[model samples]
Target chain A: MKKRLYIVLFGLAVLIPLGLLSGSPAWGEWDGAYYKKILGFIPKGIQNAKSLNAPLSDYTLGGTNSITGYYLSAFVGIAILFVLFFVLMKIFKARGKSEQSA
Target chain B: MHIPDGYLSPATVVATYAVVAPLWVYGFKKLKASLDEETLPLIGALSAMSFVIMMFNIPIPGGTSGHAVGAALISILFNPWIGFISVSLVLLIQAVVFGDGGISTLAANALSMAFVGSFVGYYSFMMCKKYRAAPFFAGWIALVSSSVLTSIFLGIQPIFWTLDGKPLYFPFGLKVTFVALVGSHMLFFGVVEGIFTALVYSFIKKRQKVVVA
Candidate 1:
């Protein structure tokens, strides 16, 4: 089961760049300017809403090559998830020990 | 559907966070109980699978694209709570690091995509376990359920909140949101999710007896 799952993840990782082939955005997940162009005005909240500067905004890195960026983003995302789970595991273990002692 | 930060009203944000806070706390407890040496690697790999699968973003007709969330596979294989927590963590990473979603809308996105998707997929698989296509239907229903909730959140924005004849927040009403978001999912992405879930579930189960390193 583990080996099969790993194979699937690796296969998907290798194919991750295919995700960038379609340049179109998901429905209803568009830019504020899309609202302005279609509805004649951007919604107030959407227009005024403050956005944080994400390190990898829209999954694109510093360079213009999107395929490479998407690949990096996939690896990075996966690594972060694993790291978080490991951290959570450590925290849980520590708390369990404390509770047992109590 | 990853809602951006300002798409929802403040009231909606607060309300969603309030609803998700307790669920997350309880879900974390559930996850802690389930996670052990034997299951940790499997669960982590499944969560990573969910993240990687979402990157596919299959293009559909009508100039929109979406991806099949691998939530159903996890939900059926393990349990709904773990699926929920796993995907919620994925969404959090997307929002904070990739900017795929927004921080403010995290609660709402988690609710629809993680919580609702997991529960719907889990129950659907259980009910249809007699059939080989249970995972397919589970994935289809899970994505559809997530779409329904996301549409509701996006659709209700303009109805309640507005400013001086101009709509505020998400401008689309229930009708448009339901048609565009839900309609697209049911027709295109849902099938992709269904097929992926069914194929992957069977693949994993098939190799269980092999025990290859």
Candidate 2:
């Protein structure tokens, strides 16, 4: 029952990101160093950096304008959280079992 | 930053290997001591987890996506050295199996991601776990901070202080990309990493389970 709450949290995390991605402006080009179902977010600096060949630090990398990125981030982010919660819960359960047996 | 073979001078490579070899020995010894028979599966699981987690690439604001390197996770599950070994395996797999990184730079990548990233991040995390907020902080700090540190290590030219030569440009395009790549990862991933690591660690702590490693 407790684990379910964690799952719900994970789901919510991903949904917000997906909504943002679906409503973004920069999702047009399928190529030009940013194509495919996976090549998700393109920071403004990174776009310029990749094109201009500037130093990485020279360009600022932020996700303030990224919608798909937020969605993807949330999904994977929450998945990781699920793993954590599951493992911790199992640990707790095992300890309880051990304690009662002892 | 994946340090390709030709980019680093042979001397640099040898020196790096020198620093890395002793740590390898020490980590092996540590593994031998703390690792009990009951934890055999943990080692395998850690290795598998390293291999698997790294493939799930997350797209950044830029068109490219970066995957979690898994050094911190391995360290959380086992001793840092064991995490080091496990991460090395993951790198090797990426190079050979996935064709992601170059084969020549394996040791350097391992040194940064596993040896340095895992141990430093993991130990700091261990210390941080005493407080209620530490779990989230530790996870965020471990992955995000390690991402930056590894980027610097990869980008910084070893010959910055050469006395006889004029300033070499030593263009670090990949290194630069690495920072942007890893830095972005830290900023974005930290929030999730903190939540994930804390909850996961909590689970393991709750179960009295030591990740079989």
Query: Which candidate wins on DockQ?
Result: 1
Best by the TM-score measure: 1
lDDT of each: 0.91, 0.51
What value of lDDT does candidate 1 attain over all alpha carbons? 0.91
Local accuracy of candidate 2 as per-residue lDDT tens digits, B1-213: 334333343444566677777877777556554444345446545554454444334555755444455567567656677788667655654554333443445666678767766776587777966778665666666666656645554445433522234212122344564657466756665566566556665665655544433
User: Where does candidate 1 stray beyond 4 Å?
Assistant: B209-213
lDDT of 1 by residue, A5-90 (tens): 89999999998888887888999889987997899988888998888889988898996689888988999999998888888888
Q: Quote the lDDT for A24 in model 2.
A: 16
Candidate 1 lDDT for residue B123 = 98
The residue pairs in collision within model 1 are: none
| Alpha-carbon TM-score of each model against the true structure | 0.97, 0.57
The TM-score of the first chain in every model comes to 0.96, 0.38
Task: Looking at model 2 chain A, report the run of 10 residues with the lowest lDDT sum.
Answer: A52-61
